[model samples]
Target: MFEILLALLAGIAAGALNAVGGGGTFVALPALVALGLTPVTANALSRIALVPGALAGAWVCRREIGPVGPTSMRELTAVSVVGGGVGAGLLLVLPASSFDAAAPWLLAFATVVLAFGRRVSQALSDRLGRSVALSSRALLTGQFFIAVYGGYFGGAVGVMMLALWGIGLGLDSAAGNPMRIAQLAAIFASATVLFLVASDALSAPLLLGAMLVGAVAGGYGGAHLARRLPAPLLRGVLLTTAVTTTVLYFLRG
Candidate 1:
């Protein structure tokens, strides 16, 4: 009962964070690890559980979804799906010790990105005096790599996407947010399929179901709430979550 409740609350927080700005894995992955699942299994299960939440957020923002710069939405999504599947396959094939060793570093890297990605994007934009327009090939290539990261150990992948778009396409994060949510759904959906078929995530069915239910509710509500919350407040919440998660992971290591 305690584990179920904990997972449910973590899922709610994770789903809300993802809907607002990303970093859902920062919450869900750690929570599952605390529940005694191995790091690799926790990562896979968290991705599986969050799929519905990402989908719910995407559905709510479907009308606002659009292409990122020179890349068409269709092509970008295709790349994300393929890259995500490949990443998931990598996770399944890799040794569990490798994920355990890398988990803290991945969390730290994600936290740094969440903290400074926007500032860096803005700075680059200011220096250039215009959006650095990447060729479509470049944009797709960048997105594919990010999707691979998302599939392997997504933490702030949505924020990373927004930062890339902000720098390369001069797209505003607010304007690109819906599309971020949609692409997140695509990545997680692909990853989830791989996890279900190839991983041991289903071994903890109760916890997974609890988290999934909470994530769905939170995602739907968070998408609506995100429109109303002040931007600074949302960023503050996300940064706090990211920082705290990263710190705890480092300490645990």
Candidate 2:
């Protein structure tokens, strides 16, 4: 019962984080693993539980969803769906041990990116004397790879996307957030379908259900709340989550 409650709370925090800035997996994944699921199964189940919440957040921000410069949302979403499916397939085929070993380093890298991505983007833009914008094809290709990662592990993929778009197309994080949530939904939705059909993600029905419910509530409310937050505060919460989660993972190792 206690573990179940923990899962519920974790889901709420994760969903809220993703809605605001994207670091939900850092909470949701570790929470499941601590509950005794294997790393691969935890990853699969987290994706399953978080999809609806992502969509809820996306819906709240639907009016704010906008273009990524040259790349239309339609094209990016198509690539995300296909790439997410492929990445989910890979997770099922690969060894679980591999994922367990790689998890900490992946989280660390993502933490660093989430922490400094925007600043780095601005730095590069200043260095070049203009914001670098990718062609439509290039942008789509980059999104494909990120979506693939999103399906496979999905910690800070939204932040990564924001960083990429900010660097490549000079997109503002706040303005691009709605579309980020939407694309995250698309990626997780495709991945969830594959996991439901192919993986043991449904083994813990109660745990999944609890988290799912909590996430939906969190995502819906967080989206609206995020609109009122100052950008720096949002980034601070994201970074703090990332750092704390990364430290916990390393300690567990």
Candidate 3:
């Protein structure tokens, strides 16, 4: 009962974070690992559990989502879906020990991005003296790789997407947020389908159920709350979570 309650709370935090800024994996993945799932299993289960949350967020932001730069929404989403499935396939094929070894480094890399990605995007934009939009090919290529990463680990994938748009098209993070959430839903949904069909994530029905229910509530509420929250405050809280989670992962190593 306590574990179920903990998973529920973690899911709420993770879902809210993903809706607002995209560090949910840092929360969800760790909580599952601590609950005795292997890192790879935890990753698969968390991704599966979070799909509804991502979808909820996307639904809430549907009206605000638009084409990103020169890329049509249809094209971008297609690429994301394909790339995410490919990545999830890799996860299932790879040895579980490999994921365990790589988990800490993945968390660290994601933390660095969560901390500095926006600043780096701004600095590059300033250096260019104008927004330098990527060709459609370039944008899709970048998104494919990010989606692959999202399917595999997905710590701060949404922030990575926003940073990509910010540098390439000079899109404001706020304006790009709806699209980020939508794409995240695309990535997670694809990954979840693959996971459900091939992985052992369904083995832990109780934990998954608790988290899924909590995430549904969190994602919907968080989407509404995001419009009213200060961006700086949200970012600060995400950064803190990212840092703390990353440090603990490293120490656990």
Candidate 4:
């Protein structure tokens, strides 16, 4: 009962974070690991549980979503699907110990990206002396790599996508965020399908179901609340979550 409640709270927080920014994996993945799931299974189950929230967020921002750059939505979606599938396959093949050993470093890297990705993007833009725009091929290629990473660990994949768009297209991250959320859903959706077929994500059905329910509620409410909450407050919450999760993973190491 206690673990179920913890998972529910983690899901709600994670869903809310995904709706507003992106760092939900940092919360959901670690929580499940602490509760005794293997790293690979935790990653797979987290993706499964968060799918509803991702889709809900995408729907809420549907009107705002658009092409990341010269790349068409169809093209990006294709790359995401292909890359996500490949990443999921890799997870199933890799030894569980590999994931355990790498988890802390991955979490730390993602936290840094979440905390400073915007500044890095801005610096790159200033260095270029103009808004950078990528060719369609370049955009798709970049997105494929990001999608692969999203499928593999997820953590701050959305933040990384926004950073890429901001740096490459000099687009405002805020303006591009809706599309990021949509693309995130696409990545997670593809990976979830693979996990459902190939992983033991269903072993803890109760935990998964609870988190899924909580995520749906959080995702919907968070999107609506985002409009009312101050941006600084949201950033603070996300940053704190990222930092705390990263530290915990390191301590576990």
Candidate 1 minimal-lDDT segment of 10 residues: 125-134
Per-residue alpha-carbon lDDT of model 1 for 1-253, expressed as tens digits? 9999999999998998999999999999999999999999999999999999999999999999988887899999999998898889889999989999999999999999988999998999777766458789999999999999999998889988998888888889999999999999999999999999999999999999999998998898899999999999999999999899889988988
Predicted structure 4, TM vs. truth:
0.97
Tens-digit lDDT track of model 2 for 1-253: 9989998998898899999989999889989999999889999999999998999999999888877898888888999999898889888888888888999999999998888887897787667655457889888989999999998888889988987887788787778889999999999999999999999989999999989988998899889889898878988988988899899999999
Task: Predict model 1's lDDT versus the native.
Answer: 0.92
As a whole number from 0 to 100, the lDDT of residue 212 in candidate 2 is 97
lDDT, candidates in the order shown: 0.92, 0.90, 0.92, 0.87
How far in Å is the alpha carbon of 48 misplaced in model 3?
A: 0.6
Candidate 4 C-alpha lDDT tens digits along 80-193: 888887778778889988888888999989989988988888999889855457888888888899999989888889888888888888888779878888888889899999
- TM-scores for every predicted model: 0.98, 0.97, 0.98, 0.97
Candidate 3 per-residue C-alpha lDDT over 1-253 given as tens digits, one digit per residue, 9 for 90 to 100: 9999989998898888999989999999999999999898899999988989989999999999999999999999999999899889889999999999999999999999998999999999888756467899999999999999998889899999998988888889999999999999999999999999999998899999999988888888889989999999999999999999889988987
Q: List ranges where model 3 is wrong by over 4 Å.
A: none
Residue 207's lDDT within candidate 4 is 90
Off by over 4 Å in 2: none
